[model samples]
Target chain A: MNTILSRFQIEYKPFRLDIELEFPNEGVTVIFGRSGSGKTTLLRCLAGLERSSTGYLRFGDQVWQDESQNKFVPVHNRPIGMVFQDARLFPHLTVRSNLNYGYRRIPPEHRKITFEQVVELMGLRPLLDRRPQRLSGGEQQRVAIGRALLTNPQLLLMDEPLASLDAQRKQEILPFLIRLRQEMKLPIVYVTHSLNEVLQLVDYLVLLEKGRNVASGPANAVMSRLDWPGKDWPSTFGAILTTTVADHETEFGLTRVQYRDQSLYIPEQPLAVGSPLRVHLLAQDISIALGKPETPTSVLNTLPATVLEIGPTDTPGSSVDLKLDVGEPILATITRKSLAHLQLKPGMRVYANVKAVKMVHEIEEY
Target chain B: MDPSIFDWQPVWITLKLAATTVSVLLLIGTPVAWWLAHTGSRARVWVEAVVALPLVLPPTVLGFYLLIALGANGVIGGPFQSVTGSSLAFSFAGLVIASTLYSLPFVVQPLQGAFEASGKTYLEAAWSLRASKWDAFLSVASPMAVRGYLTAIVLGFAHTLGEFGVVLMVGGNIPGKTKVVSIAIYDHVEALEYSHAHWLSGGLLLLSFMVLLIVYAFNRRLPVHLS
Candidate 1:
């Protein structure tokens, strides 16, 4: 697949953002960082909401912005969609007209999605006649998403769309977001600070620190890197495993998932067998053993794994991270003493013991 | 009080002046208010102060300056008279020009308030949705500012209807062309025709009160911002 290349250099007083990256023009590419780390600014630069004096942005064959040639595309002219943190719906228009606001503006030939498709995709049928204030926070966001999607944009940029919702509201809207990722073909560049959101939706990851790109790669690879600054590392220091539901042990109240040849037992999930799921394994939740354990173990998940890399601990004498390949790269944080006791090294086989209670059930499918 | 005691010509002239002034104000005030609501330029403050000058200055003071500006020999009236053989002072057109200037702030301030309260968030959202700048203003900003329009129109019309000193100085009591209701009512009181003064004054008081009542009642139903 071709890549979208973006280069930007922006300076506003005390902050300067300089980044250059190439990412696949498919799936969700999450820009993850702390609050003041320039994630929103980068999204604005791409959307042409904020013009960076020195920037170059290109997707496929088109150049959206090129400062050297003095080329620029205004926000209305760009074939892109943006969902803000606030829903920002037109108050005077009903839900139906709000969705139609963009659909009617684009030329008929340029529209890729129909109004009916958007209404169905966002589940906005029931609220069509109502005003925006009549809907809840989650419902308003869904309409905002539908309104953006109806524009037939080549790319979708979301700036913390879930940030304004309460926990219950977040839960209400998350499935629709997952459906958007799974069902839509348009590439999405999502900006968020929540690790949970990144784990669920991110396919490619870019880690930004102090307005600069510190790391960028596959989601799992960047999440397991131990050398990242400690402040922003622990939140994302986890392994992401792509597994499929193999069996439902209704009698034992467990769902058996398969990653390659190994099986992992988790709390019984409502998903059907053969459904794809991505499981997040935090490094702190994983413990290592030299050999496979005997029966009668309290931990329900134990898989054979190989150590891929051993790196220094962030805190002195606290713990070191062992990058393990358990079908996929899984991170394990063990003390220096345990590291020496196990005589662990690259390519050495070990047992990765994960407590069933620590396994999070938050799963997203591609 | 005999019905024959009232002429009604001044009442007709006042309504015509108020209607024409309000129409012209809407045509010009909408853009000026929109600009005031959106502009960050330093000159906005100066323009705003000029628009609001009539609100604080005495009506006769404003009338005096307008008298000079609209006289046959003055800047505006001199050129107008040279092009057309009629002098602006003591003419119906002179009354409209004076009333529009006097009621400028009434039309602009409310609309400016409405536009400011609506903010740029919705317009930006419209722009992202592929609405051009003009389309966004018409479809989004204009409809959202309906309350402001109502307030501006009512206030500008009512203020023009009740104008006294400015009309007296500029229009100067020409019987049919420039003698408005306020000047006629003054003539009645000065001539000791108490019944004639009572009838016109009572009608104006009730009309002004009802106009304000309707505006306030309608404004209560529409919020400043949609959500």
Candidate 2:
């Protein structure tokens, strides 16, 4: 059974959040956007919190909103869970009680996930008895996630769940999120402005700009597009690669991933064989050569790729975003000076050298 | 000294008056304060100002108006007496109503502030979890703002315990029925019974301080960052 949440040109007055999109029945669909892109508003609309002037919202068999018919489902009746940017935990409730609050709301028969399982999944065993105020920020967010999960929601809406956390905290909580995706079997609409958030967890990307969805496709395909100037920079720009760990060398402290038969070694991760790892190769870190350059001083990760297209960097930087089709279309950033030195062009057969592969995260998926 | 001077009727009447006033205030104040906390109505400010009139206006003005409206042949008293066959003036019920009005701001303001402090996020979370609005209010919002409710109750009770001008104007200082502690203290001093005045005044002073201490002690344990 397909769970379809279709929006027929949603419009918010004074702000143009007009977009039509279909979300799949499974995994995480990241709503990637810059700030003020109406991603959160879209999630709110889908969750029946925001009533658009005209839109059609459906989930599987249930019709949530049909503006023409004046049919709108209230937020309380909708079977969806949302985790806000800050952990919106009930201050009066202990973590265990907060989670149980959701569980009790669902009918006894409708509850598919048990309380203990949620506690274990979110690593909330220690914090179960503590109130939200007593927990750390990261712990509070985890409790919030657990609270949402225990509801057994049909679709989970996360609006930048990791945005409030520091980098170290984000790293800490991401694995639990991956576990939720893999084990819960619930579709998620995750809204985030951070590329790292999208790269680590998302299988699909709905790119939004100025309240409009600019692009929508699978994670790698959409991220690798040369048109977006984000690809040329390393820190903020990159493509999310959906590849599995093929092998790992413990002695060299590198884990090999089969990205279209191109063995790439990243910092060793404790992932089992066939474990899917979403690695984000920063655009600036990748340099394209016309042919496989033999000058190597210990950059072990190099792959034969064909340049698909080149686009200008969105910033003042002279670097260009290049789409390379190896296993999947990956984006590489090269400076204009380097581009001229190598005489690179679209459709040119080139070997891309990744100085260091940063493994974003690895989580088993259903 | 006359033994009747030390008669405990005024003390008993004072406790009864304070208890009745606080109970009525809580019952009427909670929902109104909750509405004030959540309402986006333009008239909310007006209503809030009316509730707070007792705080800014002289107590005699409030008492004088209430006494006129509730007295025999007054606007409410004529019809109320015909229906109930009892004048509300110079009665325990009159004292309760007067105290509730006098202490309305003390109760409602703290509760409103507490409700406002607890953001709409918790309500949204509860609704998204399929809890109805009422259920969310009871389970999430009420518990979250419990500290404010406690503060309101304590302040309302203490403020009622200390009321003088309103009780005197509305209740008319009848020895047993209408006499609250503060009014009784006033009557004792007027009669040159300094010791009797001291007893009632000192007791009320101790009682109000104890109420404040208890409120602070209880609230100290609550999460300060409720939002």
Candidate 3:
């Protein structure tokens, strides 16, 4: 199988990390969770950084670790590249030599990436001769990424690679990551706690909660699922609407999308028609109506959706969450009073007014 | 210029003893410093204190115990004599052991400090890039901790070069065997040979000053992270 299979169980003084996960051998598979949830611990186990962990970790047909059989491969022997949270670049080596250190270690036959290619991809030409200490955090991380890529690993592991950067630096680094995801065939197993990273980068999503795997699936499917096992809700979750540009209105500066039997509109972009786009719609931004509005409304678009379920109200006077089927699943939340007045029921069709899209990734991705 | 009043043998002996002592201390002290820097055991502080005892105790006090220990009837000296059929007290081999012990903290402490400061972050980064454990340490860890190595080497060598009391108690004033420069200078001063004392003392002072100046100059130019 073209997958990375891992099963690790380890116990610290008062904590334990137990997981069995299969990461697809393509695109970015994000192992996401809140802090202290063993997200990093899991990544370390895959890298063989945590030696005491037992059970098996198999990458494709090769078994990297199997405790019962006394089989284990050290971190350096595994064909995996890792990017840590902080840019732990070598202080003594210049950026060029830091990139070369790993590149020289791998034999020519296994070096699938050239030095020039990595330097170009990571935008490292200007910083090659400079010491790592002189670069900004983002630049250091870029060099860190470039250094790892030159090693030509089969699998790349990223442990919160952008967590150390500020908001602006994070934005500066995101496009490079997106391009890497789009271009590279190497499977990337990324660990992160940022929901924005999950929304923007993840192709496949694995949710970890308190040292346990709570949910695992495609990013959009997992994001739209309402009944989250942990309290990973509120601002932490949102529906990921994967759609394509059906048409563009140059005069209005908007792009139209056809979802199911209805259409929606997004801000105009310089994207070709039929390009893949992912939109972020929070539950609060979507409101449901009983009938299709014929009156003039400011809302840009409305879609037909069948109510699959109504979530329980957390407080007596709070809003009720709704799960909708609009070709792809999306979430909506309305106040309890509104729910009673409309007399909503499961399987009943309604019109969804998408007032605002929280964010959008017009990224060229699957 | 009589051989009885003037000799270059003491200078050569001191240089040889210091060089040999530093080499022996480096081989043994590095592992100990590495362990102290990385290990989390509760006994670390105690072990560190014992290693630093020579730094605080009077050379005479340390030499007193070593004197008994290397004596023919003492514990180590008894077995050593039987194995080698030679006495350790007041000998060149005995002088080397004294200097290694006295100069140990100078070698180990700076190295320990460096290892602790650099930590394992860069090493792990290298391992991720397919560098083996030894390669990562040599390429990543050692270079980052280079200032520590430099400090340790200079202090160990200079400290051994300037030994006076410990050598006096352990090796004594045996010509061609244990009459190091420090003792020789003292002998000259006692004999009121002012020129001989000034020449030896001035050279020792100048050599030490020059070594420190070079190290400090080089430290500023290195690209090592202070943290």
Which structure is stronger by TM-score: 2 or 3? 3
lDDT of 3 at B104: 96
Off by over 4 Å in 3: A13-15, A53-55, A244-263, A267-276, A290-292, A313-315, A336-349, A360-366, B1-6, B71-84
Q: Provide the global lDDT of candidate 2 against the true structure.
A: 0.81
Best-matching candidate per TM-score: 1
Best by DockQ: 3
Per-residue C-alpha lDDT of model 2 across residues A107-220, encoded as one tens digit per residue: 899988989898899898888788787888899899999899888898899989988888778887988998888888899999987766556678877877777767787777
User: Clash number for every model?
Assistant: 0, 0, 0
Candidate 2 reaches a DockQ of 0.62
Q: Which tens-of-lDDT digit does each residue in A156-180 have in candidate 3?
A: 9999999988878887898789778
Q: Which stretch of 10 consecutive residues in model 3 chain B shows the poorest summed lDDT? A: B1-10
Question: For candidate 1, what is the lDDT?
Answer: 0.87
The TM-scores, one per candidate, come to 0.94, 0.88, 0.91
Off by over 4 Å in 2: A1-16, A53-56, A229-238, A283-299, A302-322, A332-355, A361-366, B1-5, B222-227
- Candidate 2, residue A195: lDDT: 64
User: Which model is ahead, 1 or 3, in terms of lDDT?
Assistant: 1
